[model samples]
Target: MLEEIFREYDIRGIYERDLNETSVKAIGLNLGREMLKRGAKNVSVGYDARLSAEDIFGWLVSGLNAAGIDVFDIGLLPTPVGYFSVFNDKFDANIMITGSHNPKEYNGFKITIFKDSYFGADLQKLKDEAVSTIKAKTQIKDDFRAIKFDIASEYKKFIIYQFAHLKNMKLKIVMDCANGAVGAVLPEICKSLNLDAEILYPNPDGNFPNHHPDPSEEKNLKDIKEALKGEFEIGFGFDGDGDRIAVLTKNRNIKGDELAYLYSLVMKNPRVLGEVKCSQNMYDEIDKNGGKSFMGKTGHSNIKKAMKELNIDMAAEVSGHIFFKERYFGFDDALYAMFRVLELVQKGINLDAELEKLPKVFSTDEIKVETSESKKFKIIEALKLELAKGVKELPEVKEIIDIDGVRVRFEDGWALVRASNTTPVIVTRFEAKSEELVKKLQSIFMNLLDSIKKGM
Candidate 1:
């Protein structure tokens, strides 16, 4: 029932403490009422491999039925399959019950209304209603009134058919599912396509017995990287809900922005979008190739919104949320991204060689500065004002992009400082043409941020 559970992206928190049966039911009721206000009648619902998912699903369905909304249960599946239901089956809305790469103890909902992300202010309003209007004494029983829907098989069939050309192509690939929801469908699709693939942790285990389901951290990719040392020519790692992907070659871990750059090479006048944390080389490379590139706010929902608003062909986040509007739905799908990577390889594009062709730049991974949720955005605002006054130790600022956070552009590179919308931290990254400059930028930015935090 805590207000902090309602994040900018979706409703998420520790399963029992913040998202209990009472609170989840309230959320479902409020969400259903909101949909009713928008004239939405029925919704498709799916849950991930979390242990608490089934219990939460029943509570949610009870509340949704109370609001006179019909539910189509898609059962255990990846988050993207829930999204697919809306596009393919023409549902009014969809809700995926997933923690999405968070710890095993966490669980929540990712909602899509009319094919658009139901997030940000809309989610905040639902929080207000759910907390204030609903009382504990309100007798809401666990009356599950959901009809069964088999969207998983349809989704797998769609993928296998789309990638039929790559069937038996003699490509040795390694995949690490991390015991997440992707295991529900990916292995079967690979087998159907006759792909010579080795899938690690292909069973859906809510306990996450192997490792954390997140692929963004290099530590989590240890097994896949080790497997690639022998016969595996390429490797892929997927997050819990199967919406984010980490692609690897023998020599390099191709980031989402880099993947966007690679995908653009095959398109005619490709218009691509990247988040604020993306390296400058990604933008520069796309422009150099006679394509257009743009920078937008970070987060999967924000990226998808920008893609649709700009009619972009593709979009990517540095953390591996890649969306394609060129040939498929404009939603982040790690499963689809894997096939796209295979398509690039099949077309004779050398993944590592294409990456090597780009201009070299030194960059640091996302550096998180721990701060209270109440103070994170304040720190960002204070730092922005301080930089506007011109810090003596920092380099001359060429431009300041504040679309999501403050990305201060310099002559050689840039430094980004943004407050994470989902967690209580400020995310920072630095990129420069040389290692020395990268260090200098990081040091200066950290000092400035420290000063601002102290002042606050």
Candidate 2:
């Protein structure tokens, strides 16, 4: 059941079947056993606002307790809260029960050991170890420490204190929770700051009846934008797990890189890291502002890990996984991100003005081409080889950057082909300083990818 359900980034499956009690329990036991071996005694657990979370939490804790591991229950939180629990307490291991932006019927896990992401390869290793020990059922503890602790208060207080001047900022704001987990803390944070705001879908419900919980998709944000009625200066939307976020102004929808440029302005020499998927304008803007910018791989875990190594103040993905090592914990928190934007507003700066100043470029919003899960990575390997041959055989290419996947930069534009780490798709994006040039680049890349699909 575990193997069949495992995805590249997280484990997810249908409840009561693919994610049955026995398999999930065994997963918990294996995870707990691994944590113990790694010298972790106390571990923190949190869950999203899913209907299945209550039962999943119970079964998951039961298995962990069976392995003689101590568990801290952080009830009904965004995925980021589980990360916060690791830093807030002395504990080193954390587990978040969530399927992130997937459908409401879906649910799964995002885990970390000693504040490091237990992702991708590590996740598979855990499943493999559990499967190898099919008979490894330890004694289940009669009672475990399932305590309710309030973390939002301190998190709210920290941001409020950080932006103390925003107490009476007197700016109208609109937030679209999309019926996800962000509903728990954002309103409290906004209220504490005395920031006037209207919230849509503030109640934490798993069904997500108002709209799909993904904010990155433009169509999904229609209700939230319409709700604003051009009365609010800023808007925020969060995915189901709350790790990913999106921003909206009256005129335009701001991407993560745009937020980074606007947010980093208040600081002096702020070092920022961005993913390979970010628009070139974001990197150029950071450089122009006397700040440092590093283009790295995409993934919250990867971006967060890169921040520590690079000692960067902030990091963002095109999909809006914003991390702030500036004034708070170096994790992606949408509630905190909203306050940061409010703080920017309080300073009398325009939200879209910063983006407006940047040199305009035409870019794609992450085009995904579906491939067989087994063939996707191997096809990426084949594509990489093909790129190497094309560069050597063709004269049009100026440079190729294969740090994550492959990015070919021509004189007029650039095109990227990368396999998404989380899902079964080869992600592609194109950009150019001119709209017409961008369209040309897109056509070229699309034709090539189409031919590749046919050949494969």
Candidate 3:
């Protein structure tokens, strides 16, 4: 097994080649042993719609059983529901086997222990254990005390009951499940609410025969945009495991920070947390409305953890990961966020009009620069050092926020360059008051980054 599979967030890799039976089994064994050491007796396990999910599940269970832990299988479900099972069903720990928005060949686990997500340093420890040790060849017993639980149905019922006020909405809505695990619960919730909606790719197909599960890319949103032209008033798209969302109208493709601003209007004394990649307008808008805004590091885990610590009402990333601690749980859930957005429509708020009211600014979507995994972080460090030394070719900088990556604040705008923890790429984004300034800022950074990489 390759060490690269052990990432900052979770364990992810190509099936069989990197995460073979032995590696996965060793992972389960190590995790089970760790959980048992923490006094965990029962653990909830769920998988996404990936083709190799079941086979991996079987192997993982064997290791868990070898470590003497009981597995409560929730079968196929979204990542949020698997997280919800820990709180609602009182499971000691939960593991969701999903790839989030990655391609079909990728699969990983998002682990939760006693309501706190097991990530960062905890994941690193698990990786150390899994990699250093060898798998035992002894034949383990079958029937690893697996119990089937219906978390999906229960989760669906909870959502429907929570948003019962939205029942029988007259708005024409469209949903694209992307043939991922959202198919399991989205239709049921919408149906029970009597929503006038059309569901696309409602079946959980591992092949993803329709389009790629990631909604962040413009190409993946073609189907939903087509349905929105004349028939549907609004459209919602979900990622593979259904934690992130993409909201689209006929005139605009709403982003996460924009959604945060819209949601803040309905909140009382709201306190929202946004990542560094979020636009300054979002922070300025929240401040204008007598609400507090805090900028934190990127990533769902980082955002969620900061929210709880600060007692923030909501948190959002530019990539459509919305977390609400105002009324619901503190984790990111696309279905839950969908209901919140729909509630705005139920209140007669025009989606496009409300967005247009915000201060206009030019922003670029996340642009990735290819680099080796070994050099990604080094490049960021090099850029930061160069910025500190004050290069002549670069634009005048107000300040630099090095929380997640290097976010250089120019007098008129800001540019960000960060190392992607999950991929071998440097993610960069820029925002400015004008389109011309935006391009100039981007070019300056691109040239500086190129020069730095060449020297390295």
Best by lDDT: 1
TM-score-better candidate, 1 vs 2: 1
Candidate 3 global Cα RMSD? 1.4
Q: Is 1 or 3 the stronger prediction by TM-score?
A: 1
State how far residue 207 of model 2 sits from its true place (Å): 0.5
Task: Residues 35-115, candidate 2: write the lDDT tens digits.
Answer: 999999978888888888887887788778877788888777788877887877646788899978888877888888887
Q: What is the lDDT ranking, best to worst?
A: 1, 3, 2
Indicate which candidate wins on TM-score: 1
Cα-based lDDT for every prediction: 0.91, 0.80, 0.89
Instruction: List, in order, the clash count of every candidate structure.
Output: 0, 0, 0
Worst 10 residues of 1 by lDDT: 132-141
Per-residue CA lDDT of model 3 for 1-456, tens digit only, reads 467888877788999898777788878888999999998898999999999898889888877888888899999999999989987855899989898899899998888888777889988889878776553454444435679888888899889989999999899999999999999999888889999999999899999999999999989999999998888999999999999999999999999999999999889979999998899999999999989999999887787789889999999999999999988888999999999999998898888998888878999999899999999999999998888888786668888899999998887889999999899999999999899999988898899889988898
Sorted on TM-score, best first, the list reads: 1, 3, 2
lDDT of 1 by residue, 201-224 (tens): 989999999999999999999998
What TM-score would every model get versus the actual structure?
0.98, 0.94, 0.97
